[model samples]
Target: MSLDLDYLKLKIELFLLRKKAKKTFPEDLSNLTLWSQSTGLKVAVIDNDGFNLKTNLESIGVSVTVFYDYFKPVSQRQEKRKPYPFSQYDIILCDINDVASGNDGFGELQGVGAIEALRYNFPFKMIIAYTGNPAALSRRIKKEKSSNLVDKIYDKQWAPEDFMETFKESSKSFSNPEARWQFIRNRLTYLDAKEKEIDKIREAFVYSCLLKGNPKFLLRADAELENLTQSTLKFLQQGSMSDALRSGLSGLGLISDVFGIVAAIKGT
Candidate 1:
């Protein structure tokens, strides 16, 4: 009997391809709830003209509060120049150009000053620094170590998409139980027989990866995989190999080439 090595190779390649194509899930309320049980995040946006963007974000389930005139002079004091009570939000999104024009103490405000204020006043919150002036954003990232205070930076036109994408990526990392497992499975697919032994070594590496990064999702994934393995073994021990394989593959959404042969042999 000839082994279908070509079919196995294709199956492995496809698995690797799927792994590489896996997108980080967008962060949203569901993900936040999975981790923190928070209903909705409070966000404050400081901009001269992000009314539309704020509206869009609000439509998507964020509790958005806009402090619209970050460009008005401090001396103006005409409702627009008042300092925002920064304590109220989970995240702050600031327009760099607006910061420069608004705060006289910063004197033609730089992104660094905006970042510093957010960092000092709102140490627990995330900051997104956006600017229509690309030069200012770029200068902030390049010349100022203070830019680290901001979690992300984007141009005004792209801020909405970029912000959403950040949430998606974070959400995926937080909520997907199989992310690291899928990562390992993909790496396994590329190995030659000589490297197949590496799978034994991978458990430690995988555990290390989980430990070094976010602990919450890592623990959740580990618990999920453990339960899955236990259930699979129970099915196998009952001489229900076909049921075991089907359940395992279906649970993983995996289609191995050997599955066809197994199914054919089992008359299923």
Candidate 2:
């Protein structure tokens, strides 16, 4: 019997290709109880002209509370702004340009001053900085030193529909802790499904090599298999509690792969 090495290699490669083409599961919020029709997201806007923005948000099932002006005059820009009904809002939108017009002690409180004050003082679940400025959002964030505090930034110039779509994509603006937990649970569930699929494919490939009576094939393929295993483990270990936890899971994956390889060979 001829050992068609080329055909075996082709089969392995095709199987590997399919195994590597992992499905990207987008974040699904449908499972969250907060997504119910009556439970519209509560949003707050700190913009000079937020009527239209509020309307846009409300059209998509958000309950908006607009604060016409963001920053007060020099004497009134308190270290801590009076807290609103915390239970009501999931997100706060601050227009940077609205901050540009505020006279806070030294001069007009520009973007940086406004961002610092809001980030430090405002207690909101999420803060999204928005402006009509032509500068890129990254540039604005860096300039204002609001990288840590600002969850997202939006360009008011973007088409209204595009703006809303991008907001939905980037912001996890959950209504409550339970809702956020549900979001994470959804991701973990999808990840678990992907890992099981990978395990089956890896087992089949190992068995195929063993059946060919090609002991050297295992040596040649081990590194590639290890890479795939590591990738899968890394995906599973996302949002892990610590580096130690991630390392532990990775070690477990290696052990499982070894056991799978041994089992495949023994079965053949």
Clashes of each: 7, 0
Task: Report the error of model 1 at residue 89, Å.
Answer: 0.7
lDDT of 1 at 11: 49
TM-score for all predictions? Answer: 0.44, 0.44
Give the range where candidate 1 is weakest over 10 consecutive residues by summed lDDT.
259-268
lDDT of 2 at 67: 68
The runs of at least 3 residues in candidate 1 whose Cα sits more than 4 Å from the true structure, single-residue gaps closed, are: 1-39, 70-82, 100-112, 159-163, 170-268
RMSD of each: 17.9, 16.8
How many Å off is the CA of 192 in candidate 1? Answer: 45
Summed over model 2, clashes come to: 0
lDDT of 1 by residue, 1-268 (tens): 1358865664465344334323322111122212221225567788766556766666656688877654334654465544557665656778765554545665544545766666654433457776667676666567765444566666666667775776555323222334323433432332221232333223323322322233333423343334433443344335423332333233221221111111111110
Pick by lDDT: which candidate is best?
2
* Model 2 accuracy (lDDT, Cα): 0.48
